[model samples]
Target: MISDKEKPEGTPKILPLCYKVAEHENIIWVCDGAANVGQIGHQIGVLLTNMDKARMCCTTAVAAGSKPHLDIAARSKKNIVIDGCGNRCASKVLENAAVKIGYSIDISKYLQKVPTLDIYQADVKRIAEIVVKEAHL
Candidate 1:
């Protein structure tokens, strides 16, 4: 183990392991796409996770037919899907895998979809709060 001096000043934040905590945690799967709305969706997931409201899992792992991830999605207390646009790629991935979606939102509906990945913290906070209310997290 490292010495105390090697550690950071603040307490380390240890989020629940998605796979291990699936039965008790709300699992978030976001479409980390290439646009502003997509980027915001990703940030929303991070915000919720950091707030201990949910655990963000890898959407790609489920899409790639990873048994562990698929099981996590199915076993989660709530599977919250966040898609950046109308395409709903993230939702479709879970649907295709037969995982039930507890709640889902299309970020494009709330924010204009832009080409750039840069997003505003205000937007992220707004959307994340909406998610907390809607998903009952």
Candidate 2:
């Protein structure tokens, strides 16, 4: 099952996500998710970042006590937390880390039925769109 030519395995790498506060469009996006949201929050954040609307940061790194990640978030001009549902785990993480959220959106509001942590691709896009619209970002 193993081969010498195969790449070695270890902890997954976390690239440095820090950036100048003003260089970004004044929005720091934290892609956080709960068990009931299965990285959907993260996906939306990525979309927003790809659109050049905001800068995406790691939720896992910050939650796991990465100072660099937390520092970047705390110092952002506007820290935006996108939660996948009503649980608000992402918002809590930012709050506990002493980062204030200038704007936030819960994806559950966009759905008529309660969903598991896993989300649909269409829903992800819709959520990100609404965030951009509602937040005036």
Please name the candidate that would achieve the greatest TM-score relative to the true structure: 1
Candidate 1 per-residue lDDT over residues 1-137, each given as its tens digit: 11112336688777777878999999999999999999999988887887778899999999999999999998999999999999999999999999999999999999999999888988988888889889998
Error of 2 at 64 (Å): 2.3
- In angstroms, give how far residue 65 of model 2 lies from its true place: 2.3
Query: lDDT of all the models against the reference?
Result: 0.90, 0.66
RMSD of each: 6.0, 8.5
TM-score versus the correct structure, for each prediction? 0.91, 0.71
- At residue 32, candidate 1 shows an lDDT of 96
Q: State model 2's lDDT.
A: 0.66
